[model samples]
Target: MNPTATALRAGVRRGVIELRQSLTNGADLWNHAFWPVLMLVVTYFLRDVSFGRTGFTVGALALPGILGMNAAMAMVTMSQLLTADREDGTLLRAKATPNGMLGYLVGKIVHVSGGLVVDLAIFLVPGLFLVPGLVTGSPDAWLTLAWVLALGMVAALPVGAVLGSVFSSARAQGLLMLPILGMIAISGIFYPVTALPGWVQWVAQVFPVYWLGLGMRSALLPDAAAAVEIGESWRHLETVGVLTAWAVLGLVLAPIVLRRMARRESGSSVARRREKSLQRAGM
Candidate 1:
């Protein structure tokens, strides 16, 4: 096996064990699962809110968007978990071992990957039973769904890693919430881009979520051309291009930032800061 794959697999095995523990312990999953499920469910409800149209079928339009949104949320959650590990010194411990840092990050990818798989299943299974008309009836639609979902995860990973490195502080995690939530709100994940304000539409063009939603729409409803911001001018090329660019940029930048952060590490300084905080808290 290739070295990277071998390293990744070893890391993933460790991560899988940790994930199982967390799942059984009802730790982060309980708290984090809510936001993702809520975001998708609320978007689904909004899509079908109108009562007057018979066979209006908003579900089909919503599936691809929800899947994309869920992938983004899962990635964000994974990044935050990594940050938590860093703050608590788990990452530091990993770094002391050979390729331990690589393994640890690989483990995180494996763990989050599992979550994304679960998220896809949850999104699709419900769409099939709860919104039968919305589920893509063709093999082509299934292919599209699979492609978009995998692409979404690939697109989210680099950003997640960068965010995890940048926001090493636990408190910084809270600040990230607004921007992510806001991005989803304006990205037309729940509505058509044409219906959003011009400024919001322009803003959405800069991010992967919009591209993801557009890509999904392309596969799910080929005739709903007006719904996409670029509207088949390049088919899904714009989305693919923008997302791939972000992924590449993030891949280059994340490790540099992480290395910088690692260099600043001092166990003594961390201990001093912890003690100061404890004193301030009367702990």
Candidate 2:
């Protein structure tokens, strides 16, 4: 079999193993259920609020945002796990074997994709039955949302992987997540982007979060927004352009970053880090 195919197979196998372990350990349930459930409750309560009489329908707007949230969570959790594997010397041990790196990456993708599947399932169940606004929208809107969610995953996963490889300490997870969380806040995940300040809107244009939100809004929001007297054209176009640019950049950059991180990770170094982590935990 070709290297890509072989690597993908290995990735699938590893992902299954990791997922099973997560299930046993309770991580899978928490990640799959926790946030979505919270969001659902919040959305249900806030259903009365109106965005210009269109209504603040969580099912219509929030689902896409939650999907984006899913991407973020998958990326962060998988990256952190990869970081732990690196610190524990699993990656270092794999490096000596043929097609190891390929398999390793494959596994990471598989694991994250699995998590995304769970997240989507949670979001969709409510979206189909409970979201009143979604019921009234075009079928095309849902299709657009599907594409945006997939592409958003592509955009976020690489960046997260790169961050995991670069950030050696667990403490850095908090540091790394802060900026991303800030972006999510501004991306109109819970509210309207148009309500945000101009400078904040401009800042959002630079990242994948904004594009994901824009693409999602295009799917969910009414056509009147698009036909507005004046506004959002440059903002929307910039989002598409920036996200596409980042996707390309991530593809080129991820491998390079991973390779460098791999080169720096030796068994002894990993063991030392693991020991340090354990020591810090008083374990």
Candidate 3:
């Protein structure tokens, strides 16, 4: 067998093990359920409220956007896990093995993407019941949903890996939440972006979050719903173009960044980081 092929198989096994551990562990299971449940509760309350004269409830309109936002958030999950792994010397251990970085990255992608699919199912299955006006019966709708999700992950995860490599510490990774939250606020996740100021709309369009939301809305909503969007269309081409650009950028950058970060990992450095963390915890 080819060395890379061997590493790939090991990576797949690593990812499956990690994903199973997450599903079976109490804390991880809670983490998976918490956000979706909270979002469902919020949507339930808003389900009765109308979105202007569009005849769609606020909750219905928000559901697909919420799904997209959560899918895009897989990037954050990948980033945080990468940082945690580095802090705990997992990266260092991988570096010591043959083609370990390749295996490690493949494993990370599989786990993160797999976990994302689970999270989406958690939200979408109940969401269909709780929210109205979603076109669930069409083959086209599902096809749209499938591509948006696949591309969205491709765009997000590599960028997330790059971010994780850059942050260097758990504390630093936490700071990333603020900007992400800010982006969500402007990304039309909870409301129509056309309603926001022109500058805000432009800023929102610059990122993947808005496009993801738009893509989801395109997938799940009625044709009339496009009237509420900018340009009165789904703009599928733009969505594909923007997300593909990000995917390319991230794919190009992640390896360079990860390799650089991995080069700096050593037994002494890992031990020092562990010592510092223990000291901070007063343990």
Candidate 4:
């Protein structure tokens, strides 16, 4: 078998093992449950809130967009985990092995992506029961959901990886969270993009979060809901085009950035980072 193939196989096995471990761990299990439950509660409250005279519940409208926002969050997860792994010398260890970097990347992708799917299902399953307006029985709805999610992940994860490679410390990485939150606020994750001003709408559209939310809303919402959107259509072509552009940019940047970050890693650097972490904890 090809060496790359073997590495990929090894990575997949490692990822599956880690995911299983996470499922069994108490803290991880809590993390898996908490967000879905909280979001479901929020959704329940919003189910009655009306969106102007459109005859749609504001809650029902927000659900799919929330799903999209959650999907977009896979980027944040990737960046944080990558930063942690790098700080702890995991990246350096992978750099030392043959195709270990590739294997390592494959493992992280598998782990994060698998976790994301589980999280989505958790949120989506209970959400369907709470909100009645969604097109749950339609095959097209589910299909569109799958493609948007899969593509959205593809577009978002690489950018997360690139962000991870850029930030050398956890402190520096933490700073990224605020801006991301701001972006989420501006993105159409919890509300309609068209409700915002024209310039704000354009700004939101530039980010994947907006497109991802739009795509999910397209999937689960009724045809009439498109009236709340910019073009009064799903604009599936624009969705695909924008997401593809992001995916390409991220894929191109991630490897180059990872390679550069990896070259700078050494035993001493890892030790220094660990020492600083320990000192901070002591303080």
Candidate 5:
């Protein structure tokens, strides 16, 4: 039997176990339910609020955009888990074993992706009932959703891995959130990007978050809703191209970055980290 293959199988099992634990854990279950429920409530209140008399409710518009943002957030979640693991010596231990880092990477992806799917369903199923003016019946709607989600995960998770490898601690990782929030502000997660300044639109275009939101809107909104988007079009080709580019970049960088980060960590460093953590807790 191939050793790497065996490692991968172990990863799969580990990821499945962790995913199940997330489902059962009280804190995890609350986290899983909270955002989606909040969004559902918002969607319900805004269900009748029209977007510029176009007959499309703001609620409907927000649904897919929120979905996109949630999908893109997989990157952040991956980074969070990775950084936490490193701080706790998981990364160092994984490095000591043959193919352990590979397995660890695979496991994290599985856990993140699976959790994302479940969260998406939690928001979307109820959202569909509250938000109307969507192109729900079209076969193209679902196909677009499927491919956008697939590309989104590929584009996001590996970049997250790279980020996790770079940030030294949870405090350092928190800095990443400032830029992320700025991106979300301009990325049209809750409103039309077309309403923002043209230069701002250009800035948003450079990131995957904008494209992810665009892709989701394209999937769920009616064709006429494209008028509300920049370029007055869905720009599916551009979305695919940009996300694919990001996917390629992330895939190329994650392994090299992970290897570098792992090589830099020693048992003593990990022990020091644990000691600091204990000291902080005692304080």
Candidate 6:
């Protein structure tokens, strides 16, 4: 009956609608399936290849890291969607309604996070079949997968919202992909971090991508795989510590940044942006 509660419920419904649209729309469905299908194809070819004499196939080792990297990428999805919504005047329309920003943000989170879960399932289900050496039968493995996913989303999404707030245009948001791709390269998604240069390893560790990959590896890989990791251990404590730190930092900063960005939204501003986009497209 309360106003905020009503807004929250509306946000949930909006998120569910958007998610259903994503499933039903051809373009959205293709977007969801493309990456997972490509990854599966790559994994299939690598299934027989050894990873650094570990007796483990490259596909087996890369599978969990891929899962983590995809989870962390939820941030990019959130950021890009926010940029698109703003450009299209969706944020301005929300600004006109009571507690609309709150509802919009909550809806965005639900949609983005929900999409991430679906994408992960798409990859992991077939991945388990394609990759060997995964501890899929253990209760502990599933538990680790659960917590890592939850934490990874919490850690990444807020930061993504913040990044979305910072970029004013879709062009700028597209530029973000370069840095993200660079981070993935250094984050041990396709290989071990221990194999990278010392400075690159440190750089990768500073971001959530590496920690997410490491956490995934810790969860699914066997004990012997730890020998190939830095410090020759899973380092669960460090993973938690680093990811928690990022989650706290992002949570603390996102509200401030989003509020500032939202304050700048207006009917005139949205109209001007739309006009400019139309002009650019014509040019």
Best by TM-score: 3
The true-versus-predicted C-alpha distance at residue 264 of model 6, in Å, is 0.6
Between candidates 2 and 6, the TM-score winner: 6
- Which wins on TM-score, candidate 4 or candidate 6? 4
Per-residue lDDT over 218-276 for candidate 3, one digit per residue giving the tens place of the 0 to 100 score: 99999999999999999999999999999999999999999999999998988998899
Candidate 4, residues 218-246, lDDT tens digits: the string is: 99999999998898999999999999999
Candidate 2 TM-score versus the reference: 0.87
Total clashing pairs for each candidate: 0, 1, 0, 0, 0, 0
Q: Could you give candidate 6's per-residue lDDT for residues 85-191 as a string of tens digits?
A: 99999998887899898899889988998898899899999888878888888899889989999999999999999999999888788789999999999998888
Instruction: Give model 1's TM-score versus the native structure.
Output: 0.85
Colliding residue pairs in candidate 2? 11-107
Runs of candidate 4 exceeding 4 Å displacement: none
Give one digit per residue, the lDDT tens place, for model 2 in 103-209. Answer: 88877887787777776778667765655655325788788777777777777778778888888877667787888789888876677666788798778767777
Candidate 1 lDDT over 16-76, as tens digits, reads 9976776676666665466546655764665555423434445555666776777777658
Tell me the lDDT of candidate 5: 0.92
Better of 1 and 3 by lDDT: 3
What candidate 6 gets wrong by more than 4 Å, as runs, is none
lDDT of 4: 0.91
Please state the error at residue 164 of candidate 6 in Å.
0.8
lDDT for 62 (candidate 1)? 65
RMSD in order of candidates: 3.1, 2.9, 0.8, 0.9, 1.2, 1.1
| Residue 106 lDDT in candidate 1 | 78
Q: What TM-score against the true fold does each predicted structure earn?
A: 0.85, 0.87, 0.99, 0.98, 0.97, 0.97
| Greater-lDDT candidate between 4 and 6 | 4
| TM-score for candidate 6 | 0.97
Error (Å) of candidate 4 at residue 3 is: 1.3
Model 6 per-residue lDDT at 2: 95
